[model samples]
Target: MMRKFFLVVTTWLTVSTLFLGSMVMADTYWIDVREADEFATGHHPEAVNIPYESIGERIGEVTGEKHADIRVYCRSGKRSGVAKATLESLGFTQVINEGGVEDVLSKIAAEK
Candidate 1:
């Protein structure tokens, strides 16, 4: 009986440790790398507008933390790809090109 109880306790501790490790909070930034006109039409609720062309110049205004998980999207995948590259060049650690507006919106909706 004592051996069984020890085994159960050990298993519980291992599972608890794994669960806690997986629960680490990482900040996420959703960005719309589209022009103002396109952004004005529609955008993800959690996304901030920062045009691809202006990314280099206005990156500070968009995100201060270089290590933050930045998710970017645009009208098409082209601009977001550029934005992702630019952010990476600027020392951003986790820049994700989440594709076009529709694709991103669908992804976000599915996550809910």
Candidate 2:
């Protein structure tokens, strides 16, 4: 009985470790273009807040290595679209316009 219990516990631990490792490796990043106040109200998880107007100045800071798949968001699609264009021009290869902050936030929450 003791040997069987030890084997079962070891098997459970190995499977749980694999699942936790996969989850930690699959995180994604998005950019929230809402003003500071709006961002404070609610925003995507760990999203970088760089308002549209100041995006150009903050490009390097946001896209340090230029290798991230960045999704941009704002109050509405208009600002995020513009931000997407600017990001593309700055050589960010993967910029997704998330339309509106509320919409994007809802989608992400539902996915989880």
Candidate 3:
């Protein structure tokens, strides 16, 4: 009986956690345009790694709505600049080249 109660509680907690995580992801995300290996080393928790080259093809996977707000960053902002242009070409009306991760994170925190 104790085992069954523990399983039920664990399952409920898992489901609730997943639901809340999905809710946060669905609302907003900032893209990290660094390569996969580079991104693996370090990145912001909420940042999604989508290399600038692949962004044109893969951005739709993140958001199909062309007008959705999009923020992008990389090591020195160069890659994110390309990403910004690519997103704009793809009809994403609100693309922000947020530069480095630290800079962007601070800006996001400030905004919050």
Candidate 4:
């Protein structure tokens, strides 16, 4: 009986660790780096608006750590590129420039 209990507990811990590890690896953040008016027209369901100019001041709303996986987009690629550079300069490790809003929309659709 003691041997069986220890075996079950070990198995449970292994399974639980695998499940929780996947959850952490799956975390991602989407941001829109356009003006308020432009973002009001359309944006990704998972995206949060924080215009390019304010990224330095408001990026904490997305994440405080420098190792977060963040995806940023805008009306055009220009602003998003600026945001990516700004984030990288701030010590971010994984800031992806997701191009324009339309580009990101098309990319998501293609993935589906």
- The most accurate candidate by lDDT is 4
* Whole-model lDDT, model 4: 0.91
> Where in model 2 is the C-alpha error above 4 Å?
1-27
Please give the lDDT score at residue 75 for candidate 2. Answer: 88
- Candidate 4 at 1: error in angstroms? 19
> What is the per-residue lDDT of model 2 for residues 1-112, given as tens digits with 9 covering 90 to 100?
9999999999999999999977754545678887899899999887989998888789777555455678899988899999989888887777889899889879978999
Error of 1 at 79 (Å): 0.5
Better of 2 and 3 by TM-score: 2
Model 3, poorest ten-residue lDDT window? 21-30
Query: lDDT-based ranking, best first?
Result: 4, 1, 3, 2
Error of 1 at 68 (Å): 0.6
Per-model TM-score on C-alpha atoms: 0.73, 0.69, 0.68, 0.78
C-alpha lDDT values of all predictions? 0.87, 0.83, 0.85, 0.91
Ranking by TM-score: 4, 1, 2, 3
Number of clashes recorded per candidate: 0, 0, 0, 0
Look at candidate 3 and give me any clashing residue pairs.
none
Q: Ten residues in a row with the worst lDDT in model 4?
A: 20-29
lDDT computed for candidate 2: 0.83
